[model samples]
Target: MLPADDREIDLKTLKFVQYYIELGLQAFDDWSNFNVVDQFQTASLRYQLYEIVYSLATYQAVYAPSLRGKVCEAMRNSIEKSLTPKVMGYWKWESLLGKWSLDWDPIKKDNIMVSGYMLKALALYTGNTGDMRYTEPDSLPFQVTKNAVYKHDIHSINKYVLRNWDDSNFCIFPCEPNWNYTACNVIAAAGSVGYDRVFNQRNFERRRERFLKHLKEDMCDESGTLLPIKSTFTGFTIPGILGPVGESVSAVDTAFIDVPTSARVWSVIKHENIELDPKSGNYKLKGLSGADFIDMGSYMPSTGAAFLSFAFLANEYGDYEISENLIKQADEVESPIEELPTGSLRNKGISVWVGGFGLRARLIRFRDWTNTVVNGPPKQCINGPVLDGYDFQNVLVAKAYSPNGEDLELVLYNGRSAGSFSLRLAQLAPNASYKVSNGASFVADQNGTGIISVKLDGRTEVFTEKVQKV
Candidate 1:
């Protein structure tokens, strides 16, 4: 495990990660076959399922394989069952035997947003597992039975974007009757990249570049934020369904789609207007698409979504200070183990989505130590507590165990200014003499807990070492 290193991190971060993972898994389990559409009188099950699947795939991509294996297995199994002939052919919703099925007509299909999300999830799964079954020419959703014939290949999901490209160089299909969404267009554009990556084809780069140009030059406002919705026929900005939050909210009012999309396509549409709040230190974006409702706040969850999203992006770009502050603020609203609703957002509730964002936050905060890359190494952990202390906020952490399991390796990243701090370690050998790699002093208690004192003299100090038993 990386030669038993010592690192510093906020212990609360680990707790939050565990909390969000539990919350997400519980929500998925409670869905019990995702039959909530009939149970809750909601028609947005397709989008909801996509969110759940993406989050699940993220879990699989980031966490330790041993810890996340069973969960990922279950998710993959459910995905195969969820796909039907009708769903494979057309993205529509149908009613079957008192249950709602995602077998709608062509006109009723969810916009390219849903299509993009589904494609992304599948692509990520394929990338992670190196599974080529999805890339075959006649695979139902896309006929991959033939080896070399590209004609009539429905599995060429990339065609979904190419065929629907408008003169504006972006997709603008009607998600509902006449309303098209800008967020959907952008997501579909990003999905084109995933499509190419999965199939090893090169049909989307030019289209993607043109769409990105349209966004930078025409779609953004004075502050450089993309307008949330537009008309399909007229190619004009219009107030419409914001995103997966549903039609009850305006696209311009919520951060749901904008923040997540920013994380996915930051290279193309980096938003400079999303600023950090001076008072709370939370990165706040002003926009609310839907009316305030129970379980889902108009601004709270959306704000949290934006923070978590930025945290993910910051981690990717190696901006740990931004990532840490964003993660802390996100924890305030989207805690790991809050009481979440089990049913759909339009009818029963949407606490699960909040938890989904929380899960993403945890993934971002700990990515320095976890499998941040989709095709990176598997999950690895040290034998003892990686972190067990609190004081002077804003830091990242990682840990590993000695092969003999007699000692712990720790790594602490102080992302803030210089300061003195207290650290606690849990689950170690009780009342044992210990040696710190940094020449610090500490002792374990009867309960196997230990405390260490640290003095950081700079804004960016990474403390790493092997804490051996004496």
Candidate 2:
């Protein structure tokens, strides 16, 4: 008997995503009014905004289809406003006084790293919403497109990034001052992949493949964990300065960057490093060579939310349970309904980045047709305990389909403790037939819902089958 309400949890999670997105949007709106000086800060802030907006759009694409176009429009607007004007195929940074000074090194202003993230934003927008306003001249939204600083030159940026694919064969160097960031290259490569997805082009397949191969072999630490930085000159992972502090492979950084080279990396990470408490779904880190190197003291306030970004990644990599566990951990640390979560080390206390991760996690659970192959079957939300529970702790449930897609499989897990409990299932068609593992039978009523009571001895598992429609 978990004290938590499924509807309550859902509402809180929804609010968490919405509140943080709004927070980020409002913060950026305020910042847009001011003349921002630091190029790094501006790029970083816009990246965060793009990420949250993209996550929101992903969620709306499935669960709230009516809001999809609106959210995509919002993402486009944010990208336009966030990008500084370009000069000679690069972002032109401005000073606190709103003037682009010649004193600013034009080369340094080639913020390909930020551009990579912006590309990711645009690519995700196109991927999720199928909105082609930026691509088609006839469809361009006039008010939103007018005077926009950023334009979708995905091919040009892709070519620029590809041209700089270094001798290391792994890293993508956007510029010299930012050479150490291995994650930026991961993002840049992902941007290329996204571009291919949007335009039906295979221009960078060989390049992306080579980039991934080298990244897996050369950029990982001794333990195969993705290191935060690899020196441009040295071609090896090393302790590096992030903002003002130095660290090795920081969790927050890994969450921010570390684009998975492939699905296999997620398998490796799930097996090698992540330790999810079977009962609570609360997670802890392991296997990094320099765990102490991370500034935990600096991360304390936002550590939980920062980890949510990793949870979001876990979701992206087909580790939905791991992501769910991480989300549970985040909720326990700071209830989203009470106060907003904080940001990672670089931008601590910023509520929007916090929301961005939350939204990312929530969107991962949304029902999408595209997800059918990766995620076995459509799942009904359980009203009972998941991960952490009061009465029946550690119980797990997954919905799957038989090989022919003629029957549904409900895989169940009872971790560490067991008791009899009742659970509700939603979204089944009315009068659908169902069978329990223990020779029991049930059917959904007119409302397409059902409740089942079961007794589980300690540390037991079970299954149920749903018959497909005739």
Clashes of 2: 0
How many steric overlaps are in each model, in order? 34, 0
Local distance difference test scores for all models: 0.43, 0.45
Per-residue CA lDDT of model 1 for 27-98, tens digit only, reads 323544233432112223444454455555554444322122333444454344334332232232222221
Say what the RMSD of model 2 is.
12.2
- Please give the TM-score that candidate 1 achieves against the real structure: 0.53
